[model samples]
Target: MNLGTIGIWSLAFTHGDRGEAREAAAELEDLGYGTLWLGGSPGGNPSGDLATAADVLDATDRVTVATGCVSIWEQPAARLAAAYHALPAHQRARLLVGLGVSHAECIDRYRRPYAALVGYLDELDAASPPLPASARIVGAHGPRMTRLGAARTLGVHPYLVDVGHTVRARSDLDTTSLLATEQTVILSTDPEAARHQARTMLAPYLGLANYREAWLRIGFEPHDLAHGGSDRLIDALFAHGTPEEIAARITKHTAAGADHIALQVVTAHRTLFARTAWRELAAALC
Candidate 1:
């Protein structure tokens, strides 16, 4: 699928009001976003379930719909494959399945995640109607899994990452393949207000080994991870400020080698309707 240079990632599509989710997808498509990503969990929660793809695909005419990740442990290969095949041909063509071995903390069956993921992929290929390698991507953050994603799937979708990681990840892959990255943004000029929202959204991930390890690999020290994350850590992982400032931050990812940027606007309000922020970013970036 032609995932335009930009996409919108949201938990709203996964857990928000169904009717509003459909409307939002259509509006995002009209706003010129090339893809709509079903973001798993902002924090260390389980999210972006595989089933959410059908809802977005059915609601939008052309915007490509992708799961930020569908945990291999959550949905069996055969069942996910059946769901994929059930979609109308056109819709299926626009879908990208992001498969991941979610954090062990959240999964009761999480064990030897890498080996299990490989087995899951084997099963996907073995299903009656295979889930093609070209139509999927991996949620990879390390060298080993990154290499696997490059060889077997579309590419890696690294969430909660920074420009430096993008540079290294690009170096890890060949010229071909996708390097789609998800960026968390808080649209506020006030550092205090923005960081507050960011910290709230970041709290759950701080305790998750997967994300903590990823951050440490990318230059964050132990001190940076403590006390709800230092200013530097929050600043590095999240793009906060005005729309233009956020756009500039996102551009750094592109310059570092990201093929597509998935923009997710997180707010202090518990509500998932972030359309206002979405529109502002669309104006500045898209």
Candidate 2:
């Protein structure tokens, strides 16, 4: 729903103190970001993602607030729909629900992920206050799921991806579907320091099958995924160096056919560094 060219994606806004999260959301809006994406997968609690979206929506006036992704396994489709309908029409219009099937390792009964996602969408469609496909996005990586996203939902929101995957995703989806990609950034000039921070954030992803397979398809070698990823892999997956450098990297994604880029600034202390990174990035990109 009009997620601008660039948006801030961070778990800090969803999992942090309410006062601080509200303050940060307002500040990002003031700084000219088009959307505020609440990162992190929601638990079984029905209100978890909705509460975070509400907090950010209440804090900012024009900026859209989206769940970078809510795991379908975590929250039921009916419950998610109920929560969406519960919001005032005005607020509901500004919120975008991004649903994901999550990883097999994380989910207990992760069989037939594609079928499960289709089933979840079916439930949403059958609900009393149906959650329109136009108002939601799917976390898709593979071709089949990407096609499903285009056919059933707004579009695909591919995470931990490079420009190559962005281009591929654009080709897979119809012109009407959106191609929103998540980009991790580290604002550090030192090569070693930036790689260290990038590796820390990437280590968990390397172990995830979906991410590793995606990386390989995008031209990464097997060794590139080992030992927390090679320098080439880190460099391609993350945008690091000066604000200008990071901005340039973002341009590559947009040039490759990405409609929107959700920028997640990597840091050891998320609460302390997120706003600071956003301020610097806004200056360079906004």
Could you tell me every candidate's TM-score relative to the true structure? 0.96, 0.96
Q: Which ten residues in a row have the lowest lDDT in candidate 1?
A: 42-51
How well does candidate 2 match the true structure, expressed as C-alpha RMSD? 1.7
> Per-residue lDDT of 154-176 in model 1, one digit per residue for the tens?
99999998899999899888789
RMSD of each: 1.8, 1.7
Error at 70, model 1, angstroms: 0.7
| lDDT for 193 (candidate 1) | 88
Count clashing residue pairs per candidate: 1, 0
Off by over 4 Å in 1: 42-50, 269-271
lDDT of 2: 0.86
